[model samples]
Target chain A: MLRIILYSQWKWSRGWLLPVAVVGFAIPYFMLRVGYSGERYWDAAGLLEQVAAWGRGYPALAAAIGLLVGTSAWIHDHRGDHVYALVLPTPRWYYVLLRYTAGLVLLAPAMITVFLGALTATWFTTLPAGIYAYPIQLAARFMLATLLAYSLFFAIASGTQRAAGAVLTIVGIVVVTQLLAGIAGSDLNVLEAAFDRITIWPGPLEVFVGRWMLVDL
Target chain B: MPTMKLMLAIAFLLALPWRAMSGQAQDLAHVIDSLRERVSFWDSAAGYYDSITRADVDTVRVGGFAVITNGADLAAVEDAVNELRDRFIPIVGPDTILFQDKYFAVLGRGSHVVTEDIILAGLITDNITSQLHDAAQWYFGSETGRQFQSWLGPRVPITDSIAELPGIYEVIVLSPLTVVQRCHSGDIDACGASLALGLHQTPEEALRAWFNAADRRFLVGQLRPQWDYDLGRRADQTDGERRCIESESDADCVRILAGLYRSGMDVEAYAPGTNFHPSLPLDFATHSSLAAVALELGGDGAYSRLITSNALEPEARLEHAARASIDSVLRTWHAWVLRAAPPSVEVQPRSAWVTLFWVVVTAFLAAGSSRWR
Candidate 1:
């Protein structure tokens, strides 16, 4: 039953599996190629600032892969009104477990690809004197981020239509309020407030805010 | 006429390279002469042995590097500093160093010139001194560093500055022989320290005892800068800000610190932001006072009063915080043997193996997932 669930999830996500896996493999590898100049003057003031700026791409890629795979996990179930899921002879929680486990297992390939990519990226290159290549740490962080995003989007997609609508409404209200504040010459910036609320420490979205550095001092 | 003009132009072109080459030659010769002069001065001192100790036997707590000049061009000092830096920076991280060069004048009219006590003629700015103090801290307790045990066999252990010192010697006075021996063996900070042991002896006997490693009598007096920041003089000049005054060799600078502290100035107060340029505030006033105060308080349980007054302890005991602060100050003094010594650690590539191992383990785990479910 678990294997069947894994197979079903794989069938759904297979269309983009190759592309996402390739992207996962490429992210850290490309980051190293562009980031390190391996020169004496690499310590010039703004070099680190540039590398950190490029670091933003890692988490974004992880999040995108998570969103795509996670949303795919429940799209057919939502379309069928969860009829097939509810009618399963197994308990509802057991069914959810099977589905969650299957989705996570399907993600293993991309995670493995990232791990391999990170190892390959740092293997041949000599980083600046004090700096180190953290392939394991980087690949682990990417997997955690991917899991976090996948679980979040899965939770949203698995809910009833009304629940999805509620989240969309909240986001829409924030955008409209910010637009109105701009027109009224008021500094009541709802967009920035929402971003701060979501991205600061203790916020769920804070995980994405950390630096996804592959090579660091 | 055209042929003669061509010849003249060709001759002028050849002289241009020759002119530049001669200027380069002159600069090189001058640098060599400056080096020679220093060697000669030290060599002359070796032959003379006298038992007269100067009245001022006190040395700077952290041995100050004095660029001695006999009213000659001071530009040579810049070249010397560059030579020293080029020789050391490759061994240590740049951020871990505080290389501050101040041109202070010596005031006392002395015939012997065996010295350590130099007065900064003008006020010490919090901005630059704080930066120097921060660099001192990096030498002892920066990031996690590797312990030394390699083919090199017993490294100098510069990584942990405190660990490098012989126990008790970090705070207590040792025999003159030990201090002299340490100085002789290339300890730069040891140059002008050991007042308890060296001060009582005569300059000639003391120099012979330590093998002419350092002279505690010759004080460095810094002349104050003429530029007045408060008065807005030289504020816009490119090189005016950091130039320290040459010392005049007197009790005046120490007097100024005592005067400032006596006047109820917060000697350790946070510096004014407008007047300072560091990321954090530094106690410029206390730095001059630090050695003197610590030395005075270093005697048996004297720091207890400070600990009690500051509420660090119910009573001053030499057991913990009091001893710790003294040890810390003493560490600063020991480190002064030279201006900038790097505790170099050879770079290791342990991360590569760690990365490779993880890649294999994770790949194997993923492959086994088919059998697990």
Candidate 2:
């Protein structure tokens, strides 16, 4: 059953996986090129500025890949009304676990490709003294971020379209509330407040708010 | 070989002043250029701006004035400074640099690079000060670190540590995080004042001060709740260490105190001068303790604001909101803090081989004497 689930996930994502993995592989190389000017005397500050600017791509890439893979995991099942999985002889929880782990296993290629690319980029680059590259840390962070995004989108995919629509309506109301509050010149900033709630320490999204430095002090 | 040595001696002789001047400091212009180009303001904790405050600006101002005064081109520098002071100060907003570009247009004079640097130095400090002020207002209004500004909205200033300086750059290469750790452990003048009070402080005294300040900041910052058991433990440890000081060897006392200090036990047996803090200087063994008095009155930030005031005013408590106000405070702070501006421009680089030669010759004679004996 595990083999069957794994094969199914692979078949679903095979086309998207290779292309996105290549993009992930290219990110660190591009970041390195952008950061390190071909000068013997490079300004660490200036180089860091470029590197940091490029760092925005890491999470976005993770989210994009996570969304693609996660949605793909369930898209075929959703189209068939999940009847294919319902007929499986395994217990419900076991079948769900099989699907989930299978999806995670499929993401390994992309994660590994990104880590190796980042490592290769770090190997070739010369950072100023006192600054260092965190290839492994970055790779680990990327993995977690991708996992988080995948879990989130995958959970949303589990729900019916009406449930998704209700979530969308709640988000829209919040945005409208924030806009109206701003128009009224109230100190209320619910959007920023919500962002802070989600992105502060102990919050799941907190990890991404920190300086996304590939090479850092 | 004789002529070679003679020529070598001549070259080294001329290199002395050049070496000395190189060690003096990089020109203020380079620092300004770096500030304009690179620094993004990252305040470590709320209510505290970066460490480089009015004092650094004074050093740069005095240094810049010296360069201008001593240069053969004083008239040009003086004209630029005067133009900025009189005409530009009024219109100096966040967009003062833009105003500067416009000023150049009206006067039809080429841009004064030196004057522009001095102005940038002022702007950088102002930028830091305002961010601090905003942070303080936010924190004071709502005692939480949650309310952060959307943008850094300011240029960066040198923070808890100085920029990597030449000669001493190696000593100060620790990142801001490392400095903050040292500060949390009570090593760096966490309050941004220098530890250069010309008094010999032992490791024990330094550690003692660390424990005390950590305890103070923790208390004032309201880091731990009033009912925290750790506070009691820290106080007891301080007492035990103080009692142990009398019975044990000073070395042993330091060992005991060090443990207690690390454990964060505040010393009940502590007296005013029991162990002097690293940066806080008292009027005496018994009178006017700066750190204690300030905390008793307010919090660590207030006390810090008193001495360093990364955001607070020294004399006037001036609001550095607009460019005009920022420029005003910049002018006022310099006048009040420093002595008359010195003519301390970089000295002409001369050779240093003569000193090197003499030292070598002396070493040679000393070695020969060992054989002669």
Candidate closest to the true structure, highest DockQ: 1
Relative to the real complex, the DockQ score for model 1 comes to 0.07
Candidate 2 lDDT at A150 equals: 68
Error of 2 at A126 (Å): 2.0
Residue-wise lDDT of candidate 1 within B1-43, one digit each (tens)? Answer: 9999999999999999999999999999999999999988766
Give the number of the best model, judged by lDDT: 1
What does candidate 2's lDDT look like per residue over A1-217, in tens digits? 7898899889888998998899888888998887776332124545666777888888888888878876787788778876786677655455555666787898899899989988999998877655678887777767766776666666566556765787799889889999999999998998988888766644556545555567764
lDDT of 1 at B334: 46
RMSD after Cα superposition, model 2:
26.9
